[model samples]
Target: MEWSRRNIWCVILLTCLVFWVMLLVGLNAVA
Candidate 1:
């Protein structure tokens, strides 16, 4: 159960990181 929870958090963090990177890239392109 603990492992599953940890895995879910890791995936969420990774997804958020990717989203941030994309947002930065989009802003940079706009400016």
Candidate 2:
């Protein structure tokens, strides 16, 4: 159960990182 919880957090963090990168790219494109 602990391992599963940690894995979920890892996935969330990776998703957030990808989202931020995409957001930055979109802003750069607009600018």
Candidate 3:
């Protein structure tokens, strides 16, 4: 159970990072 919780957090963090990177790239392209 503990391991599963940690794994979920890692996935969430990775997802957020990917989203942020994509957003920055999009904004830069627009400008």
Candidate 4:
């Protein structure tokens, strides 16, 4: 149970990072 919780958080963090990267890339392309 503990390990699963940690994994979930890791996945969430990674997803957020990826989303932020994509947003930056999109903004750069627009500019």
Provide the clashing-pair count of each candidate structure: 0, 0, 0, 0
lDDT of 2 at 28: 100
- Write the residue-wise lDDT of candidate 2 on 1-31 in tens digits: 9999999999999999999999999999999
Top model by TM-score, which number?
Answer: 4
State the lDDT of candidate 3 residue by residue for 1-31, as single tens digits: 9999999999999999999999999999999
The window of 10 residues in a row where model 1 has the poorest summed lDDT is: 1-10
Model 4 TM-score (2 dp): 0.95
User: Which residue ranges in model 3 land beyond 4 Å of their true spot?
Assistant: none
lDDT (10s digit) by residue, model 1, range 1-31: 9999999999999999999999999999999
Please give the lDDT score for candidate 4.
1.00
Candidate 2 off by > 4 Å:
none
Candidate 4 minimal-lDDT segment of 10 residues: 1-10
Worst 10 residues of 2 by lDDT: 1-10
Give per-residue lDDT, candidate 3, residue 20: 100
How does each model score on TM-score? 0.90, 0.90, 0.93, 0.95
**What ranking emerges by TM-score with the best candidate at the front?**
4, 3, 1, 2
